[model samples]
Target: MHISDQEILAMMAIPQQREEAFKLLVDKFSQRLYWHLRKMVVIHEDADDLLQNTFVKIWNNLDKFRGDSSLFTWLYRIATNEALNHLNKKRTELLNSFDDLENVMSGRLDEDPLFSGDEIQKRLQKAILSLPDKQRLVFNMKYFDNLKYEEMADILNTSVGALKASYFHAVKKIEALIDNELF
Candidate 1:
């Protein structure tokens, strides 16, 4: 018989039983969460820093966590916000507006650290990087993360219907880019 996550979480709510539970969560989610951050920032060091920061936040916020959504949804919300905030701070450092930053990233795939991979996947990654930020987030959550629309809604703080529409548009844009070999 399997113990559900919520059951484990309940046990972990007691400070004495929390270490193993927290370790389990860290082990379970670290890589997937890290990759999520990597997809956005495209810098290995930055992703590593943000990944650690995300877990640190989880550790601090665990007690405050409302259990209103799944654990992954809560964590993804933190991770995504961390990634976006990192980008925004960096953008400000460069004295660029968010829109200006988007314009630059539109053509930046060839140089992004996170885009290092084999031919096909790298091509796909570049095309993904060309998308608007929300669309990229939606695509990553839906396609790579395999998150449901409901989970995405929680993480993004968007309605499920909006996520579906964003996903549809992202797929369409990717198809168009692929057809043109613009990746």
Candidate 2:
């Protein structure tokens, strides 16, 4: 049985139904959010940890959600922030440059048994990893998740024009990288 976001929110507003509402939220969004985090983090374990942290924050701040945007957008914003923060923390802790971290993540992707992508997909992911964080986020959301620019704007709190420009640059860079490697 499919439940709508409004139904979930309505249930959440009632004290008696809050737990059930949360369960529904988790069921509805977990896999999608996990993949979103996994694409960003590149390691299954790290993505899982970040996913857990995202849920914890969601549970803590559920009441603070004012429904200014769709539930999906709000949830995505939380997950995206968590992933970005986790990456930033890792970068800070390693005392390495962003490129160094990207190289490390690329190595992890190669070694990751859980990564089931074929060679081309792996190459694409490496190209994606080469992007700056914001561009990576924009590319992942638009290319993989198929979110609209307006939704991405809401989730990332940036203008649609900025997102379009970022995606354009990301695609150009990826195309250059892929063309160089493939040909």
Candidate 3:
């Protein structure tokens, strides 16, 4: 049985149905959210850990969800924040430059057993890893997840025009990287 976001929110509002509602939410969104995190973090274990953290934040802040955005947008916002926070924290812990961090992430991708992409796919991912974090998020959301620019604007709290620009640049950069590597 598919429950609408409104129905989930209504269930969450009732004390008796809250646990069941939360469970339904996890069941519905977990895989989507996990892939979103995995794209950003590049390692399965880190993405899993961050997914757990995202849900924990969601559970704690359920009541704070004002319906200003759709439940999908709100959930994505929370998950995106968690992924960005995890990446930022990891970057700081490494005490290296972003370029160095990108190298490390590329190395992790090389070693990640969970990653089963072919040579071209690995090359594409390596190009993605070279992007600035926000640009990477924009590219992943648009290119991989197939999210609309408006939805990305809502989730990232940015303008649709800005997202379009970021995505354009990300694509250009990726294309350049791939072309350079191939030739």
Q: For model 3, how does the per-residue alpha-carbon lDDT over 41-126 read when each residue is reduced to its tens digit?
A: 98989889989999998999999999999998988888899889888888888885555679899998998888898989999999
**Global local distance difference test of model 2:** 0.93
For 55-161, candidate 1 gives per-residue lDDT tens digits of: 99999888998888888788888999999898768778768444656555545655765555777776677788778777999998889878889878878998999
- For candidate 2, which ten residues in a row score worst on lDDT? 92-101
Per-model TM against the reference: 0.82, 0.96, 0.97
Residue-level lDDT for 120 in candidate 1: 71
> Which is the leading candidate under TM-score?
3
Model 3 TM-score, 2 decimals? 0.97
Model 2 over residues 1-183: C-alpha lDDT tens digits? 799999999999999999999999999999999999998998999989999999999999999999989998888888999999988888887785555789899999899999887999999999999999989999998999899999899999999999999999999999999999998
Candidate 1 Cα outliers beyond 4 Å, as residue runs: 1-3, 96-116
- RMSD in angstroms between candidate 1 and the native structure over all alpha carbons: 3.2
